[model samples]
Target chain A: MTSTTAPVDASTTNRTVRLASRPTGEPSAENFRIADEPLPTPGDGEVLLRTIYLSLDPYMRGRMSDAESYAAPVPVDGVMEGGTVCEVVESRSEALEPGDIVLAYGGWQTYVVAPANQVRRLDPTRAPISTAVGVLGMPGFTAYAGLLEIGKPQAGETVVVAAASGPVGSAVGQIAMVKGARAVGIAGGPEKCAHVKDELGFDAVIDHRDPEFKAKLKEATPDGIDVYFENVGGKVFDAVLPRMNTYGRIPLCGLVSQYNLTRLPDGPNRVPSVMQRILTKSLTVRGFIQNEFVKAHYKQFQADMAQWIADGAVRYREDVVEGLDNAPEAFLGMLRGTNFGKLVIQVGADPTQSA
Target chain B: MTSTTAPVDASTTNRTVRLASRPTGEPSAENFRIADEPLPTPGDGEVLLRTIYLSLDPYMRGRMSDAESYAAPVPVDGVMEGGTVCEVVESRSEALEPGDIVLAYGGWQTYVVAPANQVRRLDPTRAPISTAVGVLGMPGFTAYAGLLEIGKPQAGETVVVAAASGPVGSAVGQIAMVKGARAVGIAGGPEKCAHVKDELGFDAVIDHRDPEFKAKLKEATPDGIDVYFENVGGKVFDAVLPRMNTYGRIPLCGLVSQYNLTRLPDGPNRVPSVMQRILTKSLTVRGFIQNEFVKAHYKQFQADMAQWIADGAVRYREDVVEGLDNAPEAFLGMLRGTNFGKLVIQVGADPTQSA
Candidate 1:
């Protein structure tokens, strides 16, 4: 398609969501305030871009709290930081043209002025542009690096992951299967469970919501679990503990279930029991963020994941909301396990669509 | 000192303490009953040995209970299993000779008949015979393999270990220092704490019994803990958890404090918080039994430890009880943190004493 490069001045209006207050338990609509602001211009070595897709992930919950964490908390009255796929509209640098699509950390805003070098260009010919914020980006890399580096699944072993239909867990299960291991996925309901087993090609899928979930897991894996990719720790983790085999590896990636908990759960502390299992089973329970392995594994992941995607061995699903105004509601529902896939907001549409 | 081979008779007398009953909490004198029986003769390819020193460790506490564990429960009314340094009394195989000191899994009994291949012969001239049960055997190997393999301490990093005067913890701290990492030792009393810091050359030491234990730990480690060699689980662990640095490695070796608990301790369930820290800090909490690394790292450990001992780089202390009748009480004391150093029962006098 032929495209004309026009120097369109920065728009007068910019939509943004400000962090109204720090969340005490579950974040609400009141925690975010939608406002309009004057658009920002591209400065030296910078580009003015409009967000096409804004990604919502579980790690954002940690950033909302004022508690000590690996990363600093999102301050009150600031836009929530997130990954976004954007189209470069105005560039002050010689490196980029007006229509080039790139991956950006633009936060929850319709328009942002970011340094050109800070954004990575994404080719429209390879995969969908929105995927740069979903499957082929942070979430996909998280699963790949954490599983191979920490989980280290061997062939014929059973690999189990909770939140099986989400971006990271789905990638983890698929990658485990590709490595010749049996992937057993645990999800919240039958639909996600079915998607995990049928679409994602997991060997087995169990619904954690079922009353007989533990028994089902036991029946599902005749050989006990060798690797458990921990994402949603709570009752699901409790159920998975006794089922882990000797020398089993648990790559603890997240604890989405406990993110909203304001107080410690009621008594009969299971810490001793957990320690007992660790000693008896000789288990390796490692917690890791993907950034630790990015230096060593990122290049390999790009090559392998791209090949897997092209060969039809790996598949992904995305759940998209229509507007920037809907982001807060979409994110709140995501924390409640209402979103079916990698949730993304369609802040704007592709300019190439009209060509 | 000329050695004479003792004739093995099928009807030789043997005395053993059987498990009278499983203890509810702390083991009492009534929990053990001494019995007299005829000694077992060596079969083909077997050797008979008289126990010299039986090693007492926290793991034996698990064997006393009927609960499930990594290994099968020691059968009720059976002689308690343990590691021992013994002298061969009768040899049916050419591999072993009478008066040869060897390391054996001979249990807590006066005499044992087992295959010659099951025991490793030790050189009495090279080192003290009891060293096989303390600084150069299973406990020492446990410390070395777990710390180096799982903990992987880098230079300038801080390593914290509890029960610092015990064989494993003492070795771990010294090894961390050898790797150029700061070693912080945690023990139950002032005397043991002093021994860990003053004698063993640990960078810092904290008494877990002190009312300001946590405050003292904070003062000791200006930089957060990088490796926590977890040997004692309880309030000591609770204090250490928050102080762990990002990407911390925890080698979960033994939980001496929780071994005697009949039920879970009363408190708010801390598993969620543990999982949260695991996720946020990117910690690696690995539980291991030393036998797992025997094939991979044992040979190197023996060479390195032997040289360290010979050069006085690694020193060990032993608390010996004089008779077999005192073993149960000594072992009970070891579990309760009453016994210092490596607890060993001297069932008989060393024949080399005459030399």
Candidate 2:
């Protein structure tokens, strides 16, 4: 292996954003604490990585809460956990070298010392390194595996996805289209809806904010929905549910809308009605996290997604936040539907983009 | 061809129960109008049958209302629709001979004419002819298909079913035991619970009516539930939900508890919470009607269920309400959970029982 490079930063410190406290409702800046610590020294077979991009996803909100989940919650005082595209600044492993761009769980930090084996090296020439945290990463695999394995959208069937301008939903819609299924997207505003339909090639896009959103969704999906990629659950799910055709399949990936809520909304508990609907329609609602299907579908997803990107069959958009300091606000904005596309925090300089 | 047998009924008229009006909540005697019409002649390819037993099931409640469902609702003033075990009194087709025992959708009528091709002949020698609508029929098939196809209870896993003394739930629990999975039954009364545990051979039984019902269920399913055959969906479901293990499969067949309710229960709408639990646990909640799998698994079900019954590995119970006039009350009682096991209206003389 090439000799390890000296620390590149003039400041011999690493900055991190830690979870100061768990939020009761929507997370605020008070929930996070930014601090500087001595630069971590790499142990044997470990690499020091400088964060280039930090993914801000809806699932991150789940990690912030202490609720029971598929994965453990990010503890208070711990560095806010997230996927990151990093550049290996110093390496002490045969597997990685200095200046190697790799994918790592570097979180909301300027630097992370990760075992070399834990990070997968990214070839910058193949694609922009930022994609290691966006279109070609966890979110993309989430769309691929959940949609295909659970949703199983058949050709000519309608597949509806909410948050259609975001990473997972955008990929879900595009992949549904790839499988010859009609892709109807649900996004918040006119701009995002337009991006979803025109730029992303979705057959139809509904503005969930519009008063006539449900009507528009109904009009868009004339034959009824066969597959629903459920990343957003709240009013959008309420609207899409009645339109589900017999034997419809819903891949429940995330409940982004419910994540921030302090308590359940008052109601005549509609669980019975929902269960009745499922019974009558013979619907399949399966919840899954991306990690469950990684072993079976990750390689295929990479190859197929790469080909789709190259063939112009699948397109993606990125909403890049400028710095680590802006990550909390950007993440909050994402939860509030202010951000569009794959929301990413550009924590540091991107060498690949510069090239 | 065998000669046609004279109509066995003493009266020249067909006595029928018609849906007089839709029930607002609980069905009453007034909802059913018992009427008589002149015996009709069989047309070509039709056979006139004297109903022996009419299957009174939870699904018939759905057919009572005008609500949209998989099958059309029974129109007011129309003969109440049901599955029937019948004896052919008159045959106008070569496929069926007079005195042949057959299964048909003969509705809640003493005597009716049905197309010969639409009915399947049942040999009384193989088992009791009433088994066509009980242990060997729709409810049995429902338990088989929903459990194996959707619930997919793996060996050593826990499989739970409500209404455990009833046809569907009893079969579901027994079949789980046959598959080397632990079977946990939830029933209302101590007698039914005892029957479920001692007679049906379920691994454990919980009395759903007990004050400590939920606690008992939790204790019974220490390993957590992997498969839940959901036929009774109100409080039992609420109790079962928290006990579901990660990747738990729920094959939703019916909502017997909620069937008679006029409106949803007051709540901080729990739909979001349910969806959240589903997402976090990677649960599979599927709604299915037994007929969905009839095409794919019917033959196998027939062979397997028959063998299991013959081997004494599966046991069943029938709550037979004698006389056609008692059917309306019996059906209503079934919705109230008063009837134990498979509720059947003994419409006419059972020739097979005599044999």
Candidate 3:
């Protein structure tokens, strides 16, 4: 609802990353195409936006496939859907005007024109403008909602999150600390693991890449895991299962590790083991999308998250890739755990911050 | 807590069925041995009990093995543990004297001695004395607590329960019906399925033995399952998972189908599919033992169940296998879904009913 306006730029060219093909397993650079577009004029109740930052996430991998899921797959030759921080370059509504910075689902695009009511106006004074699409946006909301609402970590209880250096997992671990619980973060290698432990202030950090990963996990969680914030599901999940204590809660948020799996691994079926463990241990495994709790918890999440950031109780890191041309490669890299922090693309320069 | 008693009968010898050896998979008659011993005498605050009805449940099978579980494995040469409806033969405490019918953990024995405070005195006038260990005791409590507390079947929602002819499953279906939800039962044979749908008044019933079971399930659950009270986990669970709706709740109380298996079945593991469906559908899968809810729900369960039985809003059937000597065969049969209803061993004469 905060705004500052300057003269409108009447002429601007837009660039978009479109899905070029569907992926069978992991996506590749060939699956995306960059296209140039003319400036879109605002219609009634609409605002024309110049995208500043575009978020690249593992979920985008799901949208590229025509598999059965909660959401529909992105069609080949369609703009890849994503969250972006944008500035209003033109306005045709009473609600918004030129130069206003706002958060919009502008996809992997340099410009977007949307209904004024559809975009959330953001103030640069609250935090950095790009945080609107990073920590203070969907990923931050995901961790806040899933952890507190479902994981329900108690004082001194151990809460484990994989992909711990990323946006959602990092926020999850820090928020677990904020809530009086012990946070154990699991990341890919030594660097990310070190960042999770030292910089993020997680009580313990384990590298999934270590040959002694399982044994190290046992050493780290002496009392066993009480809450596992599941972001990656594969070998990491296999390691976490046996370490779960009785009545442990699993908030299944994402299955990043399994998203690229073309077929299930061969086995003496472990599904029965899962059910058996669930039964004998009296555990709770709940899967959820952040929006499920949004109506009930969003306002409170915004207030609490803003306060946590303001008080230094919470901090975040960003892996901001440059140029709209690099989005596809960055996104593919993110799914493979190449990004160290919240991955975002600087689609255009931020008007509120000096270059 | 209520009681009535008469003079003790002092001449009876005790007969017990003990585990002769643990079986690799399905238990056979060779795995059990019957022994004769002198009746146990009450000491101080203890009472001598004559087990009238011995409940045979799927959970009992877990106790027969050395495998790890929530409770300790019943030791080799140990009497098979079970819920029993007993008649107090002698009491040294102020709680009761002789001839008071009660519920006790008397195992597969003809007579047991226990602390008077441990046995719960039953009111035969309110419901049959045998009902204490059948529909009105642990099995009944399992259904009420797991279904309502965990599954949380909303009015008009569809609830599917397998092994639907057994005590736990039947009670689950009836309780789902009581909560105004549509109950779909899955049993092994046409006869059991008929009993489930016709006598039990379940909205629908499918025979898992049918070659067309998967399609039949699809037809039966037109709205998809909102709550799956998982009693038999194997192909039954395989069929149920895909049919689960968004936000579906699964109260996993038992995995009777896999309890006897020594090793897991060969597979391209379906655990990934389980996790995937959970994420995509936003489901809640919780496993619990009924006793966990006893302290909170027992008082209300007793009152509500008694009222339901009195009003004919609920009904139950008993599959009574007479005498302690036949306990092994009846038990092995019960595990294979041979029993039509609540399976009980008639270990002693019921004073309130003629033999």
Model 1 chain A lDDT-worst window of ten: A1-10
Cα-based lDDT at residue A84, candidate 3: 90
lDDT of 3: 0.89
Q: What lDDT is reached at residue B344 by model 2? A: 91
What does DockQ come to for candidate 1?
A: 0.79
* Per-candidate RMSD, Å: 4.8, 4.6, 5.0
Instruction: Give per-residue lDDT, candidate 3, residue A278.
Output: 93
Tens digits of lDDT, candidate 2, B196-266:
98898898999988999888888998999999999989888888888899999999999988887898999
- Residue B224, model 2: lDDT of 91
Q: Quote the B-chain TM-score, candidate 1.
A: 0.95
Give the 10-residue window scoring lowest on summed lDDT in candidate 2 chain A: A1-10
| Tens digit of per-residue lDDT, candidate 3, span B51-118 | 88998988888888888799987888888898899988888989997888889998998889999889
Model 2 alpha-carbon drift over 4 Å, by segment: A1-11, B1-11
lDDT of 3 by residue, A203-232 (tens): 999999999999999999999999999989
Q: Over the stretch A138-216, how does candidate 1's per-residue lDDT look in tens digits?
A: 8999999888988899999999998999999999999998999999999988899889988888899999889999899
- Compute DockQ for each candidate against the true complex: 0.79, 0.85, 0.81
Ranking by lDDT: 2, 3, 1
Which lDDT value does model 2 have at A351?
Answer: 85
